[model samples]
Target: MRNHTSVTSFILLGLTDVPQLQILIFIFLLITYMLSVTRNLSIVILTLVDFHLKTAMYFFLQNFSYLEISFTSACIPRLLYSISTGDRTITYNACICQLFFTYVFGITEFFLLAAMSFVQYVAICKPLHYMTIMNFRVCKRPIFCCWMTTLLIMLPPHSLGLDLEYCASNAIDHFVCDANPMLKISCSDTWLIDQMIIISAVISFLITLLCVVLSYMYIIRKILKLPSAQQRTRAFSTCSSHIIVDSITYGRCIFVYIKPSAKDEMGINKGVTVLTTCISPMLNPFIYTLRNKQVKQAFNDLVKRFKLLSKN
Candidate 1:
């Protein structure tokens, strides 16, 4: 019989084994990380400094951008280090910490997105009552709830992982210390953990997605009823960017976590995870700023301020 012992550290196999490809991957990820940081930080700063962006929509967007920065930071730096140094090993405790924070940020994003959808619904459907309904006090509640609820919801699965025995091979076939990869390396039966993950993912995904869908449905109904065709176009334009972001974020996430197991498709899983962790953060700020005229004006205003300060 094979002796079983707790793993002290894990070896991350990373995206590719080829040395040449690793360099290319490192360059790609470094550029992506820098861009993600710059774009998200710009959004947060712009939202704070620009009076025009103080509405509930920008408030939610700023929080979401901050979350994106944090979420990408939690994984990308470590992945970059591993790629650069050819050191794929991570301490077990570090892996657990990474896993915990990743889920917290990821789950919080769903709630935030739903909250943003609610803001859109109010802005479009009840324009007259928008300010009254989505005041600062009201906006703060959902943000707080998103953070608290996700923390509580994620604690169980993270704790469950801490209890599992990892006697099997410690080589993880992905760049990040995600739950599925961690579970795959555990010698102990993870049927319970697997079920827990599925249940949590399903409930969270469905509830948030339902909220977004319902919000958009009501929005569409309201838009269609508007007498002016131009008004309908404007309403649809406001939502199109959000819909794009939602599709990218939820589509990849559902593909990864909603399944019974992702262990079998390590290659595809890694690609999708790269999109979620690296690409999503980079894309979100651009989507919001470039697609929305208000944000573009805000950004341009900020630039002019900087230029004026420099001249002074």
Candidate 2:
């Protein structure tokens, strides 16, 4: 078995080999990437500039928006370059860096979502104590811990990949430097790493999902107890957007990462990856804004201010 140190670069076999299809995919992904960045950045800016959005909820939303931007950026730019230039060769170190950052951002999103769910739980189930529970200090701690813990947890697995021997073929079958695809190319024994990945994925998903479910369960129970139907509707509406986003994010992630045979289905894996990495980030701003009257109003106010500045 050849040491990975000798393998300077690996070729990426992207989504399709057809030249025409590559161009089409390039255009489509370019548009998707741009829209994702724009929408996410808009949410961040809106949350920052709007006085009405200075609450803990919007603070969490802003962090989430920034996370989405970083997450998609890590995956899409390399993908775009591969598709547009038809040059899919990535150096060994570069691939490792890509994998590391991707997992870092991906895991960070999990914790961020959990934090957001907790914020929603407090807001709905304990409205009286929502502010006290999710004040600036309390809210900032989770975000800080989420990023720090993700960095620490992800480093070991990524370092393990760096230590792998790559005597086998250096062609990655997917568009991104996904864990399983990278492992498939390694000549070293990957059973331990594979098990580690599976265990980690399961644990992370279950723990965060349990938190979200518990939060939502309490939220639903509280909403059901409301005497007025209109009050119940109003309470439910506030969380509907978060629930939708969480469903899409977690559904795709679980299908791709948490399954026993996840690595065996490259086609479905790529499709699901695209949904989570590209499509979901773009959809988040629209879902949050459309469902939220306050965000919509803030967005409109920002647009008018922009127009006034342009006229001047």
Candidate 3:
């Protein structure tokens, strides 16, 4: 790690400079951050405690929930703090740490989503063998691999970023310590690292998305082959939640990160990033739970248990 001797800390040019807008942004972020953490944590807790949700699908969901909580927490709280207080100066070490965790958790989610899609495919396309294929022991392997794969992909570029010399400007555009903005301000030759970052992102996106698409193709085909309309509907219904979540997860990321000149639209990108990190996490629990009967039933049972304990 090259010592960033000249620049001890970077000034994060948060969302806006206007005090009134800042107040509103702070309040909005505060509510969303709290709700995102709570709802995602609720999913994690429900999956752990609810017997009805003990399947492989819920296992992947529980991991996804944990990822949602972690990914949002990695960036949102820091932004909230920056908005609330006037403290936008993040230290060199702190900024690097933030960037690392943000990328790790965020990238890991793509792999996990692909894993979830595979679980869905097995459940739908190979119902007879679903349990044997996706049992608890078998399920843990993919989840472990997801994290390991993400780390392997992310570490090289992230480490290369640390050696970036910043003698000139430390005022990072937009909120978090994102790679693009940090790269914009760095005084080093960033071509190689930039390509590496883009390649890593593209590789992650394409590989995971291919898994999702192929899984869904088989799933759809299998669903169509069911003789009765009711059976097809039921099968599709089981996958509806995953499909919606996948669309949102992949769509937003593609819009924000896939482009060559991501730094060009820093302003628009920040807004999308807020939506990605804040609103999406808060909304996902609702998206997954509201459309599914099993999760709702599990939640109601959990609520009743809490109520009975309070009375006791």
Candidate 4:
């Protein structure tokens, strides 16, 4: 048992062992971080400034973009710093902070995506009562509720950390501070902590997954019944977007949280966490551009504004 002063820091093993290769990967991720920040910030600004984009879809999209920006910023900058300097160690408290916010945003995202799916379901399936029910307040309420719920869930992870004693290794296996990897170092029985995490995982997955499935089921049924070819095409178009977003978020998340018995498989799960944390932020802008018309117009308008401003 080594001297333990609160497991004050951690070491990260990122990318390649070769210095040259690590530098190259760092540059690539640096470019990605730039694009993620620029694209997501652009969406946030456009959603706020564009009068035509005041609809419920764009409103929620703005929130999504903002959250993605926060999530990526938290994860990527640290990873980039590690890559450049080869100093992957993060302070123990800092590691906990990272773990806390990562899950908070992640779980919030889980619920938010379901909420957005529900919004689309209402718009497509119950077109008659869409405006009446999905009023500004109703939509905004869930956004607040999901984040508030996320904060509450974050407390348990922090509490679990407080209970653990780090008598052995302090080096985290992966690039960032994650719950399961962090728990792997604990010199204490993790029965309570592991059980709490398991329960949280099951509850979040079942509730959010069910809501998305039901929403889309109704969405598909409504699309099939539409009389005109154009309406049916448009409805299918929208449904496809929701389905795509759902697949990306839920798939990576399910893989990350759902425990496997093998250590090798667990390593694989940790590796793919980069997908959830780093890659997903990049996709949000593309999702909006590909699926939502208002975002396209907003992007075009923003480009024109910048060009005109440059001429001045």
Regions more than 4 Å wrong, model 3: 1-5, 257-264
Candidate with maximal lDDT: 3
| Residue 301 displacement in candidate 3 (angstroms) | 1.0
Ranking by lDDT: 3, 1, 2, 4
- Candidate 2, residue 41: how far the Cα is off, in Å: 0.4
Question: Candidate 3 clashing pairs?
Answer: none
With candidate 3 superimposed using the best TM-score fit, by how many Å does residue 129's alpha carbon deviate from the native?
A: 0.5
List TM-scores for all candidates, in order: 0.96, 0.95, 0.95, 0.93
Please provide, for model 1 over 1-312, each residue's C-alpha lDDT reduced to its tens digit, 9 standing for 90 to 100.
666987889998889889899899999999999999999999999999999999999999999999999999999999999988888999988988888888899999999999999999999999999999999999999999999988777877778878888775888878999887778778878998898887888767889999999999999999999999999999899988998898888899778655545455777788888998999999989988776888899889999999999999
Predicted candidate 4, C-alpha RMSD: 2.1
Model 2 misplaced stretches (Cα beyond 4 Å): 1-5, 257-264
lDDT string for model 3 (1-312, tens) is 544447789998998999999999989999999999999999999999999899999999999999999999999888888877799999999999999998999899999999999999888888899889999999999999999999999999998998888865899997999898899888789999989988998879989999999999999989999999999898888899889989998999778655556455887788788988999999999899887898889889999999999999
User: How do the residues 144-187 of candidate 2 rate in per-residue lDDT, one tens digit apiece?
Assistant: 99999787777667778777887758899988888888888788
Question: Where is model 1 more than 4 Å wrong at Cα?
Answer: 257-264
lDDT of 4 by residue, 167-240 (tens): 76887778778877778888788888888887787767778899999988888888888899999998888767
TM-score of 4: 0.93
Q: Please give the ranking of all candidate structures by TM-score, highest first, separated by commas.
A: 1, 3, 2, 4
Error of 4 at 76 (Å): 0.9
